[model samples]
Each structure stands twice: as C-alpha cells, then as structure tokens.
Target: MKKKRKSLFWKFLDGVEKVGNRMPHPVTIFAILCVIVAVVSHITALTGTTVTYQGVDPKTFKAGEVTVKAVSLLNPEGIRYIFTSAVTNFTSFAPLGTVLVAMLGVGVAEETGLISTSLRKLVLSTPKTLITIVVVFAGVMSNIASDAGYVVLVPLGAIIFASVGRHPIAGLAAAFAGVSGGFSANLMIGTIDPLLAGISTEAAHLFRSDVSVTATSNLYFMIVSTFVITALGAFVTEKIVEPRLGEYKGSHTEIVEDITSDEKRGLKYALIAMILFIIGMVLLTAPANAILRDPKTGDILGHSPFMNSIVLIIALFFLVPGVAYGIGAETIKSDKDIVNGMSKAMSTMGSYLVLAFVASQFVAYFSYTKLGTIIAVKGADALEAAGLKGITLILMFVLLTAFINLFMGSASAKWAIMAPIFVPMFMQAGFAPEFTQVAYRIGDSTTNIISPLMNYFAVIVAFASKYDEDSGIGTLISTMVPYSIIFLIGWSILLIIWYFAGWPIGPGAQIFL
Candidate 1:
C-alpha cells in the first residue's frame, strides 16, 4: 500500500501553524519590542531622524507645520522616566481598569449560572429546522462572558447535532465559527469593546492629544455585523460545511438538556430587572433636562455625564440582572457570593495583567520617542504617494490585518502594536480612529476560525476530536475554511457599503475625520 500525499495548500497551512506555535509568549514579545524601541530610538536620534507633518503646531497649539523627532529611551532622562513611569504606566493604562470593571459584572452573571442557563434555553428552544441558526446565533451572543462560549456552546452544539442524528463535527464547526470568527460582532458592547477603544484612544494621542475613543465607537457597526455573521455562519454551515461533513458514522450519542425550573425562574427575574433598568436609563436620558445629559448642551452622547458614565452603566447593566437572577435562583444567599464572583473574575486576569504591564511600557516608549507620530506621517505620505487613499487604503489595511492575524492571536496584543502605527496613519489619511479600529476588527474576526494562533483554536479541535476521533488541526481548519472565506468576503462588502454610504459606524463615530 502507498502512503497518502498532502496538497500544497495543506502543507502551507501546516507550516503556518508550526511557525506560529514556535513564537514566544506575547508578553515576552512585547518585552523584546521595548528593548528594540530603545535601541531604534537611539539610532534614529543619533541620525537626526525627523518628519514634518501639516498638523497642529506642538509649541503653538495651532493648525500649522509639526515636526517630530525620535528620542532615545536609553538616554539618562529617558531611562529615569522609564523607571519612574513603569508603575504609572501600568496603572494608567486605560484597558486595564475597563476590563477589570466589566468582568466584575460578567463574572457575577456567569457564577450565578444565568449566562449558561440562558444559552442552554436559547439553543434548546429552537425548532429542529432552525437548530443551526440558533446555535450559531447563541455562540455569537455568548461572547458577553468571554471564553464561556468556547467551553460551553461549542460542545453543546456537537451534542445537539448528535441528538438529532446529524454530523456532530458540522455542528461544532458552526458553533466554533460563530464563537471565534464572529467574535467582534455582537449585539451588545462586550469586554473587548472598551478594551480596544482604550488602545485606539492611546494610539490616536499620537495625532491629537485631546482625542478619546469611546466604547460605543463601533456599536452601530457591531449591531449590523451580528446579523451578518449569524446569517453567513448559518449559511456556510448548512450549505457548505454540513454537506462536506456528511452523515456521522461513529457511535457518539448525547442528549440536549434544557434549562431547569429554577433556571427558568432566574431568567424571568433577570428579564424584569433588565426592563426596569432600561426604563430608568430612558427616564434619565430622554428628558430635555435629563440628569445624564450635558448640563448646558442638553446632549447625551457628546461631552456629557451620560457618555462618561458608559463604563459604569455597562458594569451595572450586568450586575443588576445578575444579582436578580442570583436571588431568584438561590445561587447567591448573601453579598459574599457576589464578592466571590468578582474575585474569581479578577483571578482570570493574571495573564492579562502581566501582558498589559509590558504592553503599556511598549506603548509609552513608542509615544515618548515620537516614533509613532513620525511613522504615521511617513506611512501616510507613502500611501498618498502610492494613491492608496480612501477606500483603497482601508481595504488594503483590512487585508494586512487579516494576514497578520494568522500568525498572532491575541487581538489586544496585536492592536496594541498595530494601533500605535496604523491608527494615527489612518487618521492622517482622513479616517477616524474608531473607523480604523472597525476595519481592523473586521479583519481580526473573520480570520479567527482558521488561525492556529487563536487561543481557543486548540479547544475547538478537542471538541471536534470527541466526535471524529481522528480529527486534528487539518480536520478543523478544512471544516472552517468556508466560513472564514465567506465571512471575510461578505463582511468586507458590508464595510465597503458602510464606507461608500458614509454611515456613522457608532455613536459619534464617523468613518471620516
């Protein structure tokens, strides 16, 4: 018997996984980058490197010529600043507190069993014909609790399909596609929203010191994308992935368990609590002299008390319903349960805290050295020279991010590096920081299902192996390629439409500067 041969495409993908897997941890990578910045800054400063841009004059604070030059972090002043600012950098990093606060509420919801029960009810209640769509949609929505979707919904999808005598791997593919590939598209602003917005704001500081990117910056776009990803995910699963997967042959059986009576009672309590909360918000923001509105401007979304309160509102949004559900379900007999939930959530941040510390230093160094602004000017100049302006420039950036995502997984880590260069570059090319962030997200999300570097990619493979028994990276990637391809193409087309239409991507977030 002759051994089987693999195609060039599979070989290429295999090589990609191997190379990505060999890379150092993201924190170590950032640490290496910090040193590189110090050395590069020294060289650039010695060479008297500078770029003059037509923008606000730094000294005069007027719209005029601005010249920027690299500053060496290895110098005495720079070294002292770095040593002194390390703690400040870590503490003042915007995303750090945003994530920590948001997770507290989400952690309560998860610990109270509200999120899991809600998902189970949603998926189980679907009609037989709509199982695929429901599973995928639930997977998309499950992002509210971070990694819960991968750990819960993906396997539950397999169990659901197996119960219906369908191919379990197909179900797994659909769920994985939605959970990972549709990560950036959610009906609600998730932990990632404020997290990325903070980084974008830091990056935007390169061009304009007063700029602030809000968590709702991409809210409208995210709303549209949720349905887009859901439709695309379901379509690919039924039309392409399911057909390829065929019928299940292995003897695997599992039951689709529905939410219990206690869980049902808890859900109802959560719903009532949520409705009342919304009513309260409307009363606060809908009146002409609303308390949450700007005191003089009568505006809610602009420079108002409401806009600034978004992070707090988000925390309470989950906390309110979460506490209600806990009481109804008898999960939280006292306040200690809530405290425990919050602590558990913070415990998960051990790795993120480390990564954020190093990344904050890296971002600080980049800003202190003026490399970010100089590069932005240079990159924008080059793009202008190449006629890659407007739509073309944005499209090309989406492609570049998508390609880079295959080798690097952590979205925050990648954005922390890319934003310092690209966000300001896009702003210089006449795009808003929010819009640039949106394009980056479209690319980052669509490639996640196929990327071997995605943190949950191995977990997905493990789910698949439970059904197929012989499944590996190739098995999972091949199953997900259709989703990744269609999702990228379809989502890009939607973004193009948004660009040409010039619609506001979110609250106060226009595509152009």
Candidate 2:
C-alpha cells in the first residue's frame, strides 16, 4: 500500500510538472506583466493619484497620456532612432558583436580538433573523483569562450561520466552548475566583467557621482566564488542528485574509445602551444613597464592594453593551439578544413541565435514600455519603506531577484534594468553597489537551473531524453528543482554570513554604504 501510495504521489507530481513546463516562457510572462503595468499606468493616469516613494519619481509618475498611438512597425523615424541609439550605445550593447568576433578565432581552434583532442585526453587520464573536479573546472574556465562550454563541455561531461559507470545526468548537472551557476565566478575576467562593470558604474553614479566601479571590481570575490560553487556543485551531484538517480542500469551501454596516436601527438602540440601562449601573456603583463600595462596607471585592471584586448588575447590563445593541434593531428591539411571547423561550430549556434533574437525583441519592447524601470523603482521604494536592513535587505533582494528571474531570464538584461533602481535605492538604505550586485547574482543563478525560460532549458531537456526516451521538460524540471531550492537556501545563507562579516565583495568593491 505504501509503495502504491508513493507511486501515486509521483504520478501526481509528474502531472503538475507537465502543466507548469508547458506554460509560456519567462520572457512571454514578462510581456504579459508589461500589459498589466500598462493598464495600471493608464488607470493611474485617469485617477490623478500619484505614487511616490523616496524622493525619486518615475517619468510616468504624473501619468498624463493614455492613448494607443498608431505606431508603425517599420517607422522611418523609429529606424533612425534605433540606428542612432545603437551607435551611441555601441559599447553598452556590444556583447553579441564581441562574442561573434571572438568565436571566429575560436571556431578555427575548435574545428582544428584541438579542443576535442585535449578534452578527451584529459578526461581519459583523470581518475573518477578528479574527473568531476576537472569537468567542473573546465566548465568554469570555458566561460572565457562564452557559450562554448554549454555546447561542448556539457555534453562531453555526460559522455565522460557515463563511460565511468556514473549517472550521466549527475555529470551534466555538475557541468551546468559550474557553467551557469558559477558564471560570475571565475579565475579570470571575461567580457562579462567589463560589461557588468559598466552597468555598475552607471548605477553607482546615480548615488555617488564621482564613484566608478572597475572591470576587476568583483574579481577577488569571483575567484573565491568559483571554488565555493565548484565544491557545492560536486557535493550536490554526489550526495543528492546522484543518489536519487541510483545506479545506472539503463539501456545505454558505455562506449570505450581509445585515443589515436595522431590525436595524442596533436594533444601534445596543443599543450605546448598553450604553454607558450600563457608564458608570452605573463611576460608581457607581469612588469609594470610592459607594453600590455596601462600607459598611464601601469595597472592591468583599469584602461590596460591587456584588459582592453582580452578578447583578442583569448582568440590568439585558442587559435594558435587549435591550429597547431589541427596540423599535428592531420585534422586540417588546408585552409578549407579550418573553415569547415569554424562553420561546424557556428552550425551548433542556430538555436541560440533564434532564442537570442526573440529574447532581444522582448527586451527591447520591455525597455520601450518603461515597465521594467517602474517595477524596479516601486520595488526599491517598498523595500526602503519597510525599513529592511542588512541581511533582511539582502534576503529581500534575493527573493525579489528570484521572482523577477522567473519572468526575465536574461541576467544582464535584468541587471541593466534592476541595477539602475536597486543599486541607488540600496545605497540610500546603507548598502553598497557591490553588495547589491552580489545579492542579485545569487538570486539570478539559483533559479537558472530550474527556469523553463532559460534558453538552454530546452537543450537540457533533450539531454535528459538521452537517458530516458520519455523524458520531457517536465522530467528535467522535476530533477533540477531540488538543486534550485537547495542552492537558493544555501547561497542566501552564505550571502547573509558574508554580509555580517562586512568583507569586500571583490577587489576595490565594498560591502556597505
């Protein structure tokens, strides 16, 4: 009877999961919320009641106009405005361009068989315990290449783990955890560092006009967070996720493939090339007088040649080793082969391109409606009005971020909107921008693993299907929900502790007002 009852409970949960998974994506949900806000704003405009919190008021505070203007979808005026804005805000919205350009070099490297051979050799040599750590580590490191880790290492992690008789989902979870959850945390700064720093600087200026947050502001904290997330990910996989999965008596058999001699040679060449590249970078950046150092400040963190050219640095680092491996392994005899490799890498991004386009449109519309700002401002006002402070403020921010995360999956986009409101508001409440950013990150990351609107959510579901053909979005969500809840709780607690300690969130980044 107990066994039957347990089965019925799972069945019920499965039904609930299916219903939830089939709902509109977070962005679409946000669009719906946008409509609601528009209606409310219209009503407020008619009622002549002003909503004011703190001193700063929204542009819509007076709410005068409430008419549906016949806006042309292809208005020449709108087109001109967009073009002008794009040029003006080029750096502010340039991640896509930066990622694409970097990928050109990365494409050549990945195509030439360098990444594959190196990953295979590394996985083969490492012990089971060490393999988990290395996979997680590699996942973290892959952030340097942006989306490369998601397409390459995540599946490879599953393949490698399954080969060793471990549950493949556990490995996928570990890698995903490191890749997405550990996103803000890495040993080195990437494109995100600068992008987020710019946003932070802009937000901070609202409160302290003279203050500027550098790209490396969060570097120290991120470095520490990388390891903390890695350890937590491994533990969750081994203790929680894996045990729940039990032994893999599944139908799929592990394939045993040996590394070819040519591949081994290519691996050696790639390693040598990587070592040389690293040494060169160090030599160039190590001395204050080195050309890579900032001409004025002699620092690598601010306006440094090396920092400005980090994308090019990454391209060269990957390109050189990849070409060397391709030649050594006989994967690339001519230019055509290298081109083919890059093409193959790009082929995998088709889905992402579609997702990004839709997401970008939604983000653009949300910005146009001015709904995000209004909500953020109102939220900040409410928090301040409630007398929330310290850990209470941090937790409130986390929960608020998490809730917003459900309707807005893009971290950068969400932060772009939220930071302007929250950072200044929190600063007024005696919290620093760094502290607010950190709290927002915790909330943003914890929900990523479970949010259906996450672009990769579909991909993860497909990955899960490999284990169980019947697996759907429902199955994947059910499996990952535990991690989301646990991570939120655990990470929130850690933030509270970090808050009480009053430690610097990162280099030159403070925790308090």
Question: Would you estimate the TM-scores of all the predictions?
Answer: 0.62, 0.70
At residue 307, give the lDDT of candidate 1.
66
In model 1, pairs of residues that clash are: none
Q: Can you write out model 2's per-residue Cα lDDT over 222-273, one digit (the tens) per residue?
A: 7777777777777777766676666777775465467899988888888898
TM-score of 2: 0.70
The alpha-carbon deviation from the true structure for residue 81 of candidate 1, after best TM-score superposition, in angstroms, is 2.0
Q: How close is candidate 1 to the true structure, as a TM-score?
A: 0.62
Model 2: runs farther than 4 Å from truth?
1-17, 20-113, 141-156, 162-169, 187-224, 240-256, 279-319, 347-356, 408-434, 451-479, 500-513
Tens digit of per-residue lDDT, candidate 1, span 1-513: 011115464455455544543556556766887999899999999999988765532222233345778898988998998899999988986556656677788789878977667656655676878989888998999876565677557866886777676888888888888898899999988768867887788778888898989989999999999999999999998876776566688988645567778878999999999999999999999999999998998866534787677656777888899999999989999999999988997786675677778877776787788776565455545544665778888887777778767756667756765676677888988899999999999888988888754655645655576676556556777778878889999999999999999999999999998
- Candidate 1 ranges with C-alpha deviation above 4 Å: 1-10, 56-62, 127-256, 387-513
Question: Going through the candidates in order, what is the number of backbone clashes in each?
Answer: 0, 0
lDDT (Cα, 0-100) at 483 in candidate 2: 59
lDDT for model 1 comes to 0.78
